[model samples]
Target: MTDDAMLTSKHALVTGGGTGIGLAIARALANEGAKVTITGRGQDVLDAVSGAGIHGAAMDVRDEASVNDTVANAISARGPVQICVPNAGIAEGHSVHKTNLSFWRNIMATNLDGAFLTIKACLPGMRDTDWGRVIAISSIAGLRGLPGAAAYSASKHGLIGLIRSLSEEYMGQPYTFNALCPGYVDTPIVDRNQDTIAQRTGMTKENARQLMIDANRHKRLIDADEVAAAALWLVGPGSHSINGQAIQIAGGQTA
Candidate 1:
């Protein structure tokens, strides 16, 4: 199939699709002719990016009722969701000593619980179809412990575990489950992290940002589109055997 028609009739639901990696992936799917429903907490943000085969739905991933209702509405409008991308998450860093129970729960609720709810809501529709893809946006922290980010790292690690188990559960089926572990992507999240790091470490914002850039072997921050390209590839042809994997998109080896 032509690139523009590869996802022609498929419906894709991307949470946290208003900005950054989620937005990039949503746009990529839409360009390939998927009816994309991009959800976020901000209605205006979603509206700004709506159209051109992409629709918008304001939903909070942390809220179970909102996730189920919004997903059902999306399915009713656009048909079964063949592609589910759970990318909504917070990337805050705090040492384990400083992290409170509430803070840790918030991280898990948005990052891990959110993915579980999204996949659960969309899986039935996907199962009714002949093919399905559940691509969870994990982090490099998921593969390795990130210093001073115990809660965030744990949430991402849980996400990868969930994806891996699902992949095993549905082995040999037309559906595939995988997680994308990206490192230091140049997105709004990184920008926020830079500021946070600066305040926490008493360094200039530039130095804080440089710290992330240096983390990558390429010595530069990864573009959001680079991660988006990986998502597109997973949904594209010849990716059937790529299931149950934690594909890393760091500039080089993370281990």
Candidate 2:
């Protein structure tokens, strides 16, 4: 798709847009002239970054009533959502034996159930529009197992399944559902995880960081903009042929 053919005069909604990958994707969509609504749990961060064609709303994707109300409000304010990006998630590593039901449910609530509710609420608005894109942000672990992260992996895997089935359901329709499985990205989450890794593996901070970097197989953390570019392509013109695919951004990971 050409620059001019990208999302212009269209409405888009991105969850967890306060920072990291979601913010990058929201900015990219906004740059293409889409009236993008970026949702997050932080009002200050959302307000700090939102401007131009971007609007920020405080939304906790875990709550069904909140998701329903927020989507309704966003649609009423900016028209129907043509592009829905379910990018909000919690990434962490917890041993299965040590993980409790609450821990597991919390992960599922935010990663799996959150994506489910966000897509479900946005579908009505998206279906009403002439064109639509539903992109779920899953992890590379969604495609395979990650040690000590059983719950997280399962949640991401479930998200991919949801997107794939939805894409098939709307195969002939104007809506297209897809998943972006990015490896490690340079985000605040990574910074936090470094501490976790250091504690778990008894490695120095630098060594812990290197461990994740090496895990990417490309031996580098991804830039959030790279993932944003993929989202732009899927919504851009001539991308109708792409659907129901888990587009992995993990560089050459043999895992």
Clashing pairs in 2: none
* Clashes (N, CA, C under 3 Å) per candidate: 0, 0
| TM-score: model 1 vs. ground truth | 0.98
> Tens digit of lDDT per residue, candidate 1, span 233-255?
99999989999999999988996
Give the lowest summed-lDDT range of ten residues in model 2.
Answer: 1-10
CA RMSD, predictions in order = 1.3, 1.7
lDDT of 2 by residue, 58-154 (tens): 9999999989999999999999988999999999879999999999999999999999999999888877767889999998989998999999999
Model number with the top TM-score: 1
| Predicted structure with the largest lDDT when compared to the true one | 1
